[model samples]
Target: MTAVVRHVMVRGRVQGVGYRAWVDHEARAKNLEGWVRNLRDGSVEAVFAGAEDVVTAMITACRRGPSLARVDAVQEEAGNPDALNLRRAGERFSVLPTV
Candidate 1:
């Protein structure tokens, strides 16, 4: 499978609603490697790296985050794994400190 990486920003009532943790859980479950964190702008930022299809599914999932999360918009962009310091193999998904 060809691996792909993406950077996503989830907006709306994302913070203070367990969004990061939910993302961490989902990403791990999909065997994705990257990180999720909250932004001071009241949004959630995440990087997903894995099989192309799996990463796409993860982005779709971000649209309707955990029950409490009211995700308004999900913006996506091409991601550079190197920029995120992700290994091409065996990296773990994690919840990162807010940026």
Candidate 2:
């Protein structure tokens, strides 16, 4: 499996809608290594790392977030797998404090 990493920025009505929790659950279920957090500008940011296809699938899922979320945009770009900026050591997936 070819591994890849992606940094994503999700815009729109994502906050206060269990978006982070949903992402945490989904990424872990997909065996992805990453972190999700809320940004200062009312946006959500996340990093996903794993097999290319799986990561791609995760991004697609983000576009249609949780039932309560109204995802407007999903911006994705290449990420550095070696430096995912994980909050705690040895954690597979994390929900980081808002930034």
The candidate scoring highest on lDDT is 2
Per-residue alpha-carbon lDDT of model 1 for 1-99, expressed as tens digits? Answer: 789989999999999988998998998888888988899999999999889999999999999999999999999999987756743344587677777
**Per-candidate total of colliding backbone pairs:** 0, 0
Write down the worst ten-residue block by lDDT for model 2: 80-89
Candidate 2: global Cα-lDDT? Answer: 0.94
TM-score for each predicted model, relative to the true structure = 0.91, 0.95
Evaluate model 1: give its TM-score: 0.91
- Cα lDDT, model 2, residue 23: 99
RMSD in Å for all candidates:
2.4, 1.0
Judge candidate 2 at residue 81 and give its lDDT.
Answer: 74
lDDT of 2 at 79: 92
lDDT of 1: 0.88
